[model samples]
Target: MASEKTDKSRLRRDLLRTRAALPEGDVPVNGHALARHALQLPELTGAHTVAAYVSVGREPSTREVLEGLRERGVRVLLPVLLPDDDLDWAAYEGRDHLVPAGRGLLEPDGPRLGPEAVLAADAVLLPGLAVDRRGLRLGRGGGSYDRVLERLTRAGSRAALVVLLYDGEVLAQVPAEPHDRAVHAVVTPSGTTRFPAL
Candidate 1:
């Protein structure tokens, strides 16, 4: 168990370093490609409300994906970080509605809807450093998304859970704890990969 934790720590450090080295192109090209790939997902195509987050740093930018979803009339819900690191949600009106928030994050400036607001979403997009072929995700050492997934499970949510990653971020394996949940699919700039077979 300890060895797995150490391995996860090592992998996270290595992956984050690689991400930091990426060029700041506003990630326009990759962002738009990620958005385009997302459109091909049956889960996304069927979803009306999608719980998502804004990308900061070199993390696969959700900029184009968010804008595209909004343009297509999808009800976009963005997260607001709480003091405890759990997320509260709000409606995404547009880029102008996002304002600087703590942790160098941009959050929705709209009314605060409780955390359960994600329950109404037909899909949920998650952030990750990497994902294993089995769909286990390596997050940024924060348990926020873990809590969100727990809440979704307790609520029996049918919302499709997804992760947007860069091509190389998909790996053969990643550390996983018993409490960890597997994501349903991963959308990369190249294309989409599903887990547990649809």
Candidate 2:
């Protein structure tokens, strides 16, 4: 456990440095490509409900993707962070419904649909620093998505877990912990990579 933590900490620091060093103009272009790639995923297109987040900072922006999904008549659910860092879901009604929240993140301002709302989603978009060959994801270590994934598992939800990443963030390997869950796929700017089910 101690070694895994140490490895993740180092990997997080290194990935953040690389993301921070990216040219400012690259964010929007990559965001656009991310949206395009996400739409190309058959799971997303067939999904009636998609649980996603409002990408902040250098994280590949989901602003375009969120709006795009809504335009396609998909029921888009955005996360509302609880004070304890657990996530609740809310319906997305375009960018107007989003309000600034903690951690400089934007969340839906509608009624909270409870954390378990994600169980009904056909797809779930996760935020992460990097994902490895085996589909292990390295999040920011906040333990937020861990709880979300755990909730989905406990309820036996079949949501297609997905993550958005820059092309380079897809590393060859990353430290995996026992409690960690593997995502089904990741949509990078270049294209989408699917991990075979374990």
Candidate 3:
């Protein structure tokens, strides 16, 4: 287990370094395109509720996509990271509902919802440092999303777990720890890429 953690740490560090070296503008542009594409996926179409993350740093900015979802009559839920690193969800009525949570991340200001509410979401848009063809995800080391995904999976629902990234950030392979959650698909500026059959 220790060796596995070490391997994941090294791989995560390397991937972060590689992502940091990418051209800045390319990241946001790709992220925006990917978010737009995700909205078109069958998993998202007609889904009344969706869970999305607020992009920070190189993570894709889903603000426009969320607003677009609202315009299409889909209710959006944004995750708020708590002190214990667990996710508390809130409804995203519009851009004005966002308030800085911490570390420059923004979240909706409203009633907090439980994990069940998140599980009810038809699609969950995840943020990650890197994702591989097998759907292994390398997160920012917080492990919050990993835990949340595990909870969602254990609930017996096949909520689509989609990771947004720049085209280059999708790696050939990513070291996975026992606690790491595999994403269902990866989206980039070019198009949506489904993962290997799980």
Candidate 4:
């Protein structure tokens, strides 16, 4: 398992590096296109309440997408990462409500909800370094998302788990561990692709 994890980590890093080398305008454009496609998905379109992450560093920014959702009357929940790597939830009012969170990430300024609130979300938009056809995801190694996803699954929500990525970042396979949280779909600039069951 350790070896597998190491391999996955290396693969994820390589993909991230490649993506980073791409032009900045291209990255955001691709991300926006992907977000547009993802919004068309039934699970996403039908969702009244959605949970999304604030983009930081090289992660694709969801500011425009979130704003569009807000215009459509969708309730957005943004993740607040705690010191212990646990996630708290806060309602997204708009760009004005965002404040700098840990690790240079932006989060909503408001009361936070516990794990149960996350479970009630109609869909979740996740960030990742890379994802495979089997739905296994390679995150930033913090394990924060993995922990939260485990709690959501255990709660029987089965919320649509979608990871946003550049087209080249989606891989045919990725190393996986038993504890890794598998996503249900991947959204790229090209389109939204559903992954096979893990």
Candidate 5:
């Protein structure tokens, strides 16, 4: 267990370093491609509501994807970090409605809908550093989304779990703990990879 945690932390550091080295122009280009590709996913196309997040810093941009989803009439929910590191959600009005928040994040400046609001989503877009061939996701080690997944399971949510990443973020394998859950699909700038339902 300890070795798994150490391996995960090491992999995260390496991934983040690589992300930091991306050319300045590639971020938006990848974002545009990601938006185009992600919009076509059956999960988002068929979804009435999507729980997603706004990318920050060197993370793969989600701005274009969020706007595209809203234009298609899908209700978007963005996360707001709570004091305890759990997420509370709010409607994604537009880029104009986002305000600077803690940890260099931009959060929706609207009314908080509480964390349970994610249960209403037909698809949940997770933010991750990497996802493996087995579909296990390696998150930022904050445990926020872990809580979200646990809540979803406890409520028996059928919401499709998805992750957005750059092309290289998809790997053959990543360290996983027992509590980790496999995602349904991963949409990268290049294309989408779907996993059989868990």
Candidate 6:
């Protein structure tokens, strides 16, 4: 058990470091590609609502995806960090509606819609450090999305779980805990990979 935790920690550190070292000029290019590939996901194309997050730091950008979904008439929900590290959601009004928030995050300035709002989404776009070949996602260890996934499970949500990443973030294996949930697919800058078992 302890070894798995250590392995996750080590992998998180390494992956984050690699992401931090990405060339500044390449970030937007990757973001554009990521958005293009992600928008093509059948789940998002047919979704009436999608629960997603705004990317920060060196993480793969989600700006274009959010905008594209909105342009497609899909309602977009962006996460608002609560004091307890659980996420509260708000409608994504537009790029101008994002307000600077704590942890250097950008959150929607719209009215709070409670955490349960994600239940209405047809799909959910998760932010993760990496995902293994079998679909186990390695989150940032904050446990916020864990709570979201738990809520989804308790409610028997059929919302498709998806992750956005750079081309190399997919791996053969990543340490996982029993509580970890597997994502259905991952959309990278290069293309999308679907896990059939999930």
lDDT computed for candidate 4: 0.82
Instruction: Give the per-residue lDDT of model 2 (tens digit) for 1-198.
Output: 999999999999999999899888899999999999999899999999999999887889898999888999999999999999999999999888889998899999899999989899999999999999989899999999999999999998889999999999999999989998899999999999999745
Top-lDDT structure, candidate number:
5
Candidate 4 wrong stretches, greater than 4 Å: none
Candidate 6 on 36-57: residue-level lDDT in tens?
9999999999999999999988
- A best-first ranking of the candidates according to their TM-score comes to 5, 6, 2, 1, 4, 3
After superposition, the stretches of candidate 5 with alpha carbons farther than 4 Å from their true spots are: none
The local distance difference test score of model 2 is: 0.92
Overall lDDT per candidate, in order of appearance: 0.90, 0.92, 0.80, 0.82, 0.96, 0.95
Q: How does candidate 1 score on lDDT?
A: 0.90
Model 3, residue 86: C-alpha shift (Å): 0.3
Q: Predicted candidate 1: what Cα RMSD to the true structure?
A: 1.4
Candidate 4 collision pairs: none
Tell me how many residue pairs clash in candidate 6.
Answer: 0
Error of 1 at 27 (Å): 2.2
Q: Candidate 6 — what's its lDDT?
A: 0.95
TM-score of every model versus the real structure: 0.96, 0.98, 0.90, 0.94, 0.99, 0.98
lDDT of 3 by residue, 1-198 (tens): 787678778877877787767677866676668767978888788688889887766566676678788889998899888889889899997888899988788998899987567988988888887888788888877878878887887888778888877777788887776666677888777888897536
Candidate 3, which ten residues in sequence have the lowest lDDT sum?
55-64
Candidate 5, clashing residue pairs?
none
- Residue 59 lDDT, candidate 6, scale 0-100: 91
